[model samples]
Target: MTYKGNSIFKGKFFVWLALIILAVVPLFSGLYWQGILVLVCYYAYAAIAWNFICGYAGTMSLGHSVYMGIGGYISTIILETKGVSPWIGMIVGAAVAMCLGVIISYPTFRLKGPYFTLSSIAIVELLGTFISNTESLGPVPIKGGSGWSLSQTGNQAVMFEFSSKLSYFYIAFALMVIGLFVTYRMSESKLGYYLVAIRSDDDAAKSLGINVTKYKLIAMAISCFMISIAGTFYAQYFRYIGPDRIFSYDLSVQVALIALIGGQGTVMGPIIGAIILVPLSEMLSAKFAGQMSGLNLFLYGVVMMLVVYFMPHGFGEHVVSILQKAEEKIFGRIKRKAKD
Candidate 1:
């Protein structure tokens, strides 16, 4: 029993130790790898937001890209036309996203299983198509299919413009840390319990006097708000935003896949997924280039298949198990050495 307790402690300790190591990686890495790490942070942040509703509430939304697109477009447009700081625009975009998310989620809560998932996909399609054809919303240029590129206002910290890759890395890393912290907090909250209850069996929870729709809506709003912030980060880091890319079904799918593959209901699942898949993706795309364009997708599919079959609960579940074994081996050796 003592050993089991210590093993849990060891696992959690090392997991965070790994995070500490990730923080310093940008210092030694070149601009290219730093860029990749930034992307990993982006996906990780986005995945955590997605997991809140889909993983915890079992909503299975695939339309998250809409909020991201909205966030990026809003911030970029504001900065371009009004000279507003992206810092301020981020809050504005997140507010818009939350409102939209709640409005969209209200009716969708009536859906079930695949119907809900399909409706979400439809929403993304509808929004993306609308934005693509819209050149202007009144006086503001929607840019239509052309997208927005934000000009740098020097390396101004207040403006959210950075002259170095390390600046973006710091911002991305900070966001990821905040995300992880929030997820950990949620896991211990009453809201988390309600969400888990809703996920397990909404009908039963509703019968027990829980306002199922209300809680789900709350989760949806929170998810949208969080994801939209990441979208702001996305536009800021990349210096560009496009409906075709940000609102792409592929982006939504990848974000969901990361959380699901890592372990949907687990807080660490998305981080683990991003860490494993993003680097693998970068490597595969680089190695294959023109000839094997789809190799990454092929491998991703294989990984998804394996994870579903072997770790249906998610790879997050196995992390502790792996650590426990390592603890036993190391501690046993230490004891033997002391005895000898």
Candidate 2:
């Protein structure tokens, strides 16, 4: 097969297979388990989205929850008052998030390393505080510090409201698949290479005449749009939105954690991280529901420290390396046996 054909067979087929399994497996899962699957997809999607800018472009945003909160508020407010379908709200929310991304990129993109990270955190705190203090934007009353909630839209698929968790599961799964596909495609494209070059050394990339700022902004825009979509989905699924919940520092940490723990900069890292961490977090939450609340956080710290100490490159990279070695060893044995 040609290189293109080989790539398609190797990458696209597995993505489809994974999506199919996600879709089918939930049908057999109990209610609680199905919820976990949906949560995994949600966090995984956000992590992948964040990784586009942080991992590939090396922007290292620590305040991505800004976009998530904006998307949620935009979609929920429109759905609640205007009675518009969330299908449309998703697009609008994403557009707004993209604009904020572009706006922030101008100033934040100029800073690098910890400076950039601090700027991002500042933006999130500023936005959160502003939203909480503002009571009204023109005629529409802002939810402000109280947060907002969405009323039932009669389980209409067009409205993005569903009576069944299965429907939400499918939507979340599809979003996850889409995030993976986009990440994979971008990773193989020229833009992806440019992002990598910039990340490795912006001075060298600029010396080569590459527009580093432009590509980083592009990455930021795409990442913002993607995570914003997830935010809209979260609002629609849970039927509520709170600045604290959506715009919290914890949310931003979770997004970063998912990608970092699994293997940042790789397509499968965030997915792997989400698959393991989300479920474990949930289980810990369940176990400590009425008792020890901080134990899970402590355990997560320990796990993260161990991964950093042992597998500094991230778990996804380590796993991939191991699999390749095992495959090579098995193939070598097969060839030797045939020769004998």
Give the top-scoring candidate (TM-score).
1
Give a tens-digit lDDT track for model 1, residues 202-277: 9999998999999889888988999999999999988889888899888898899999888887778898889989
Which stretches of candidate 2 lie above 4 Å from their native place? 1-19, 322-340
Model 1 scores what on Cα lDDT?
0.86
lDDT to native, each model? 0.86, 0.84
For residues 1-340, what per-residue lDDT tens digits would candidate 2 score against the true structure? 1112113334444446556787898899898999999999999999999998898877778899999988888888888889888889898999999999999878779898989989989988998888888878998766798888887757789889888899999898889989988988898888888988998899999999999999888889999999999999999988888888798777897888788888777787788788878889888888789798876666667768888898765677665556556656877689788999
Leading candidate by lDDT:
1
TM-scores of the candidates are 0.93, 0.91
lDDT score for candidate 2 against the true structure: 0.84
Candidate 1 Cα misplacement greater than 4 A, ranges? 1-10, 331-340
Count of steric clashes across candidates, in order: 0, 0
